[model samples]
Target: MMMVIVSYDVKTSDPDGAKRLRHIAKICQNYGVRVQNSVFECLVDTANLELLKEKLLDQIDETKDSLYFFNIGKKYHHKIEKFGSKDVIDLDGPIIF
Candidate 1:
């Protein structure tokens, strides 16, 4: 599996825009862990990654919303560093609840 970071900015000024934003966020949750309100960190194989991208693309409006996928590869652990009070989420560990 490869580590991927998905971030998005959806225009939510109207009701339709808000619904789309929520739908996009829901889709991200199925494929990865949500680290922020509009960002997710996912570890998936290439095939699944492609599928995730397709799903996200279909939900977003190209003219009004933006999505970004950062392919951090398999060495994400070493490449990522954190500061401040955010607890690092263990994506590969068992969920306790």
Candidate 2:
């Protein structure tokens, strides 16, 4: 598995723009854990990563938005650390709503 960091900047000033931004966030949520409003940390295989990139590209308007993917390799665990109020979430855990 590879650790992929996905970030995006989308410009919007109208209702359509708001919808677009929500769509982008939804797409990222399908593939990773959101670490920030516009950042996600994804753990996926190479093929899935490629697919994710394609899907992201298809949704973004290049003329007004930007997307970035950083493949930090499989050894990313060794380099990761956290501090402050943020706590890691276990995605596999049961959810109560």
Candidate 3:
């Protein structure tokens, strides 16, 4: 699996824009963890990444909104540096319920 950093900005001056923003966040939640207000860290294969991109694209308006995807590849542990309160999750590690 590859790590993908997804970020977006939605024009939220109106109700439609606000709705779209929420929809976008919901979509991202299904695929990964939210690291910030509008940023997500997703670990997915090529096909799943494509699918996520498609879903995000569909929720955004080309003229008013913007979306970005940064593929961090398989070796991502060293590339990221975090100095904050929330601890980062190991996407490749076992899930503890």
Candidate 4:
């Protein structure tokens, strides 16, 4: 699987904008983990990545919102650096309830 960093900026001045923001977040959550308020770290294959992109694009308003996807490839462990209080989740590790 490849690592994908997804980020978005949604126009939240109205009710619809807020709804859209939630919808976008929900979609991302289905595919990965949220590292920040509007950033997510997703580990998926090429086909799933394309599907994620399409879903995100459909939720965004092109004129008012913006979305980004940074493909970090398979060798992504050393590419990322984090210095914060929140613990990072290993995408390749086992999941526990």
**Top candidate, metric TM-score:** 4
- Residue-level lDDT tens digits of model 3 in 20-44: 9999999999999999999999999
Candidate 4: count of backbone clashes, pairs at least 3 residues apart or interchain: 0
TM-score of each: 0.94, 0.86, 0.95, 0.98
* Candidate 1 backbone collisions, by pair: none
- Rank all candidate structures by their TM-score, best first, as comma-separated numbers: 4, 3, 1, 2
Tens digits of per-residue lDDT for model 1 on 16-86? Answer: 89999999999999998888889999989999999999999999999999999999998888997878776
CA error at residue 87 for candidate 1, angstroms: 1.8
State each model's C-alpha RMSD to the native.
1.0, 2.3, 0.9, 0.5
Estimate, for each residue in 1-97, the C-alpha lDDT of model 4 and write its tens digit: 9999999999999999999999999999999999999999999999999999999999999999999999999999999999989899999999897
Better of 2 and 3 by lDDT: 3
Using lDDT as the measure, name the better of candidate 1 and candidate 3. 3
The deviation in Å at residue 21 for candidate 2 is 1.2
For each candidate, the alpha-carbon lDDT, in order, equals: 0.92, 0.85, 0.95, 0.97
